[model samples]
Target: MKLETLSVRIGRDVEPMAGDVAPAIHMSTTFERDSDGEFSRGYSYARADNPGRKALEQCIAALEGGHDATAYSSGSAASLAVFSLLRPGDHVVAPIESYHGTAKQLRDIIGPMGVQYTFVDMTRADAVRAALTPATKLVWIETPSNPMLNVSDIEAITALSHERGAIVCCDNTFATPVWQRPLRFGVDLVMHSSTKYFGGHSDVMGGAIVTREGGTLSERLRDYQGTAGNTPAAFDCWLLRRSLTTLVCRVRAQTENAARIAEFLSTHQGIERVFYPGLASHRGHDIARKQMQGGFGAMLSFCVRGGREEAFAVAGKMKYFTRATSLGGVESLVEHRASIEGPHTVTPQNLLRLSVGLEHADDLIADLDQALASRS
Candidate 1:
């Protein structure tokens, strides 16, 4: 089935339990077990497993074209699930420009745990190939990467890692299942902060990790999620299930709105550069065009004519696009990337990342037009 079809069927189908159309939430924290002290389906507690998460996992795994998936409290939890597959001495390669929180987690949390990582220019296949070492166990990447929309060559990176017996994992939050399926390309694992595209409305917070091979890595991560206790709530799963049903529809709408806004920024006087995969001027246009199916993506970044102060002015002026963090919500958001990433980070001082929402494209465009006009 297509992603559109899969999205609708994936958590919404309840197998006619009492002939109810939508699945009901499982609110019980503990389950009744058989006399032998085993669950009917091996589920004994909410932290270990639940019917709602299983439903969501199966649905998302199907959409990502993977064998299985796991859910978490936030995208970070799902991300940690993938990283848990590594050990104290393992090394990993990641793109230089990434979400600030993830970068901090890698440096602050994992580094102290003795897991070493290198940040390279993933756009250049040569740079990725050179970064590979015998101790390298994984390659973490984001295409149309956060804050800066820099697209990575997945095929090259995956091929490079596979040659050395390393697993490749991608954070597909920016490009949801509607636009791209990483498993189709030799990738071993795919992760998402379901709070973004999967939750659509951004009301719920959750994360998911999907893998083509649900072998040792999947088993270990599942065990870690159960033991580590970062599992998502049943209510969040229920809301996320509801969000997935309309995932494709909202993404299509946001994509259209984003394209118009990006084009407007490209020509506007207050804008210096626009980072959108749809734009022909973008460096990764060819790769993204080849890898992705329909629209480019809803997330974009643009630099104002001046630096940080001017960028904040533009963000403050947005009426429809809220000046805040996080994306893939029903509403739009604008944030100055450099300020949030800190002065030591790679983000430019002049840029603002925009998460295009489901608002009318003309209204969004007009607001941006006026916002830039106010920058003068």
Candidate 2:
């Protein structure tokens, strides 16, 4: 089945109950043992597994063309699970322009745990290759990267990492499986915040990790999740499954609106620069075009003409776009990323990140137009 069809039908079947169209949320934390001393239904405890989370995992695995998936409490938790697969002294190479949370986790949390990481400009394949060492166990790739929209060549980087006997993991939050499936490009693992796009609305918080071949590494991640008890609640899993049904439709509309807005910003006099993969003028346009399907993405960043104050002014003046963080929602959002990322942020002070939504393209453009005009 196609992605659109799979999204709605993958986990909809509920057996031995009423013929309800939607899947039921199995919120029971523990399952009863039958006969002697075994759980015949394959569920013993919530920490190990839940019916709703299992359904979600199957659906996501199908979408990403992976063998299996493990859902987590948050995207960061999902990332940490992968890091947990490594021991002390294991090294990782990641993009310098990654989501600040992921960077912080690698620097502050994982680093102290004895895992070493090197931040590199992933857009340059050479830089990624150069960052690898004998101890490098993983290479993290984030295409159409956060706050900057820099697209990296996934296949090229994956090949480089494979040659050095390292696993390559791609953060597909920005370009969901609907746009780009990294497993097909030889990525060992694909990670998603799920809270952003998979949840569709800004309500639920969840994360997922899908493994291409379901090997020992996948088993280790499952072990970490079950042991650490970082699994999502039954209700959250059900909500995410509900959101998956409309994933393709929402993303297509959001991407369309973003393309229009990026074009408008590129031509506007008050804008210094626009960072969107869809834009032909963007540095990664060709690479993004080659890899991404349908549309570039709904996320984009633009620099205000003056500086931080001018950027904040534009964000503050927006009427339709909410002045908040987080993306892949029904409602639009605009944020001065540097302010949110703090002192260690590499995001330009003059740049504002926009999470385009399902609003009318013209309305979004008009809001941006007026916002920029206010600064003039």
Best by lDDT: 2
What local distance difference test score does each model get?
0.89, 0.93
The positional error of residue 36 in candidate 2, measured at the CA in angstroms, is 0.8
Candidate 2 minimal-lDDT segment of 10 residues: 11-20
RMSD of each: 1.3, 0.9
Error of 2 at 112 (Å): 0.9
Task: Locate the minimum summed-lDDT window of 10 residues in model 1.
Answer: 11-20
Pairs in steric clash, model 2: none
Over 1-376, each residue of candidate 1 has an lDDT whose tens digit, in order, gives 8888998887677456587678888878888889987677667889989889888999999999899898899998888788888889999998899887777878888888999999999899899999999999999989979888988988888999999889999999999988998898889899899999899886889999998886897888788889999988999888998788898999999999999999988888778899999999999999999898878989999999988888888888889989888899989999887887865589889999999999999999999988888654
Q: After superposition, how far is residue 33 of candidate 1 from its true place, in Å?
A: 1.1
**CA lDDT for candidate 1:** 0.89
